[model samples]
Target: MLLALIEDSLEREGWKGVSPMEILEILEREATLRRRGSITPNDVRSVFREVKKARETPVLETLRKNLTFALPKLPVSRHKVKMEEFIAASKNMKLYSDQEKSREIMDAVYLIRPKETRQQIGGLHEIKDRILNQISLAFNPRMAELGYDSNCRFLLLGPPGTGKTLLALVAAAENNVAFIKVRGGELMSGASYHGEPERRIKELFGLARQRSPCILFLDEADAIFWGGDATSNKLLAQIKSELSELTSKDRIVVIATSNKEELIDRATRDRFEPHVYTVPPPQDDDEWNEVVEIHLQKIKPYLAPDVEGRKITRMFRRERILSPRGVAETITEAHRLWASEIAAANEVRAATDQEKRTVALARFRADLERIEHMLPAIK
Candidate 1:
């Protein structure tokens, strides 16, 4: 149990940066709370080694399968635990079980406690404000007393990598609610038996309601909601029925994203009508500069003094890196290149900060040029 707990903690996004002692402390605390007995420093060290070995060995497949099989059987005084408590514990440990039959209804959905607030998202000021308002209206307890509608739904329309998904995450983060993400493809693919797809959809909504004051984000919504076949129609109907059951008092907000809005039928689009927001690429110089700065801030220390935010923004425009995701990828690749060069140089002799910065700027420009050639020409 301690090994699994430690492994789960290490798998989480920012937890890899934590020190071994800190991880041990956390494991000790969790174990003590669960009355599973105290975890010693040596125990944590051994488990860490095992975890590393498990990752490197081919037996990782068997280990994962065993973990999945054992998760539902987690002893609770020899009695079955409530689903809500089970899921809450899973979330606390960041254990996303996509294999358990008992949890198959929620297998396609994952819960996220988003670290990105509205302030963290760059550009789309108007859209951000509107989303924030909608979240406030849906989550604020006082709004219901004042006769304001709390049933908020949003359909974020945008080109690929234009921050549509990021906006949904920010909405949940800003409201301090559970972010339940469902990829339409995964949701649809999970249904094997007849009527299973419709049943999964209904149960998904039920799970959302149970975890209320949450954001039910359906990413790439057209993948499942696009009506064509009999199964697709049934799944769509189930979603619509579940959506209708949501009243103003329910703090659950449904946010869907689609790059190709035309693929979704008019009836489905009408459900999110008047609440649809288009997330376009950064339109103005200020927006572009802000985006560049936001993405480049991580590597700012290695950037040359002359590598201004506007200069990066201009490079992005020149390279036709229109999406925020494109800009981020370019910056990340450049930084990786710069760091590798610096590391290689350090083996020979320690380099000055000025040398590092100069190398970083050079790599950034080189990457931008390479990306320019790679991107398809705009019609």
Candidate 2:
């Protein structure tokens, strides 16, 4: 609380609009951060919108302009190549354009790599196989006409750290498709002049359509699409309408993920073909052991005597902990802390043995607690 008050006082000036990353940093420092997360593509989109709004604020306009100028310019040849590619395709459907968004969508898709596949994504072999097979059929023009009775749409519903987003990433990667992620809550800013969100939706879907064989994923698929607000609901309708019209793999594949599928609208729910529930960590004893072994393999290379980071994972993997994403994050953070220790170590000053022990212990304890919280909600 005292730290929060200090952070609150540290704001530059009155009505200082902050970017989403900055807000997260302050919240983490104040120890007020609550939500567990993997920062799904949807969340990134939401944060992008928030930061866009902050940049548009009059107080920060100059700062935003400066930031844009300081950033390295995107390659010119790539932009022209995408423009030519989209233009060639646009000839088939008169609806496409080379607007601001056409470039944005092209740039976004360009960042997607073919190498991001299910083979690289850890865990869920059976679920991955099932989902992949379904997508494979769905992606084929011949199978869509077979009158298969399956929910064409899917919901990757599960608790935090269960690799829901990772599965979506792998699916897109394997399918050789672009992943267009949209966040629901960030779609609604205010009723007055937030038509921008609606426009963004249209452009996003249009781009998906234009770039056939792409995946449209709504990360927190339940938030704004619910039937509570009139305008926001209409925005969702814009999405469903597009999805309903799309018939083949050539027409963009739709994959939606939500932690809470029950809250999704019944009618809206029908649009999705199969609602696959992601199984969280099992209560079975052996599963957590697998997690520990996988992560400890990564940890072993980074550990040092100064940190006293003896691997507890070698003895036991008792707790049903460490989902694939959890393992990745743990490794990343451990590396970060160790790098900090190395950087902080100098002839001028060194961490006391107790200081290093306290830091190391806190990290290990946090890792265990995260595992505890990530246990599967099933038997």
Candidate 3:
């Protein structure tokens, strides 16, 4: 069990493999093991030598010979020395450090690619500028020298599907920092079931610190921080305290989003009020068009060859406002339609530009109409 836990910790620490020495160090540092007894690195080396010796013992060789007759078969290492080499190579791998931990967090988070940077997002110009400025100040070396370690926290307030999450992603990408996303709803639900709200808070911030200079985005911020009375309120207050402590850690920038700013608890709002930015739905047709155009360009490569952008944009904007997510969905549906046409034709040749446009436009129009009616409030 100890060995399994050590391996698990090593894996979590971004060590795909380990040397005998590393294994020993990991075991010694393991919380599970440290609580029970003292285990030193030197002791680990001694154990490694013992295990190597035991594997090569004459008694083990004799037992191996008898085991063949005692059972159907037994799987055993043919070269015990190979284990030593494997362990040595692992020790040569990158040491576990903040950089390695950051890489692991980057892999786990939903990385916002370069194309999805602030440039791709339409409107929200004020919010975008504010975020970029904060990022600039945070990245500046002078911040540390001046001891101006203010929490670079921002709260995005808006209605659902108003691009709050997208803004967070774009900010992370533009700043060239690791992105760490968490849903407040999930944390709150888990806490309710297990009654470990404080621990959950610690874990979230701990990960952000491990991957310092990263953007920690908490979506649905209101869900976990608001809407609780007496009993649940105490838990909410405790969670808030945990967050309050993290405010001093300038390396981790927290961007939290909520559908309704009012729904956020008064205490929570006051805590993060100075940096809150309201993200409203697209205010006009021009903004909406830009959102559609952004998504259309992304799906264009898969679209019928040489389809005119104007026609596609017109069809998507027949008569409605679409959130960034809605636009993405619409384009995705159109791609499916184009793919289906190709599948049904079973032709060796690709469809002509006109054919692709016609088929895709028709499919997109249908899907858009259905989706608009079904989820009108989302946009």
**Clash pairs for candidate 3:** 19-87
Task: List, residue by residue over 1-379, the lDDT tens digit for candidate 1.
Answer: 2333455545542234345334544544454344332233344444444444433355555567677554232121222222233223322442122222235555576665687966657798767787778767877878888987765778889899988988888878777776788888888785778899888787677667655667899999998778888887887888777777776677788999999988986677778767888899887999988888998898888998888999889988998998999999999998987676555443323335666656644545544344444332310
Which residues of candidate 2, in runs, are more than 4 Å off?
1-111, 141-152, 190-199, 296-300, 303-324, 346-379
lDDT (C-alpha, whole model) for all candidates: 0.68, 0.51, 0.59
Q: Best candidate per TM-score, number?
A: 1
Candidate 1: misplaced stretches above 4 Å? 1-103, 190-192, 348-379
List RMSD in Å for every model shown. 14.0, 17.7, 12.6
Structural similarity to truth (TM-score) of each candidate: 0.66, 0.55, 0.60
> Model 1, residue 122: what's the lDDT?
78
- Tens-digit per-residue lDDT, 94-141, candidate 3: 323322333323233442223357767776765777766775576555
lDDT of 3: 0.59
User: Lowest-lDDT window of 10 residues in candidate 3?
Assistant: 31-40
Clashes found in each candidate (C-alpha, N, C closer than 3 A): 0, 5, 1
Off by over 4 Å in 3: 1-115, 193-195, 247-249, 301-319, 347-379
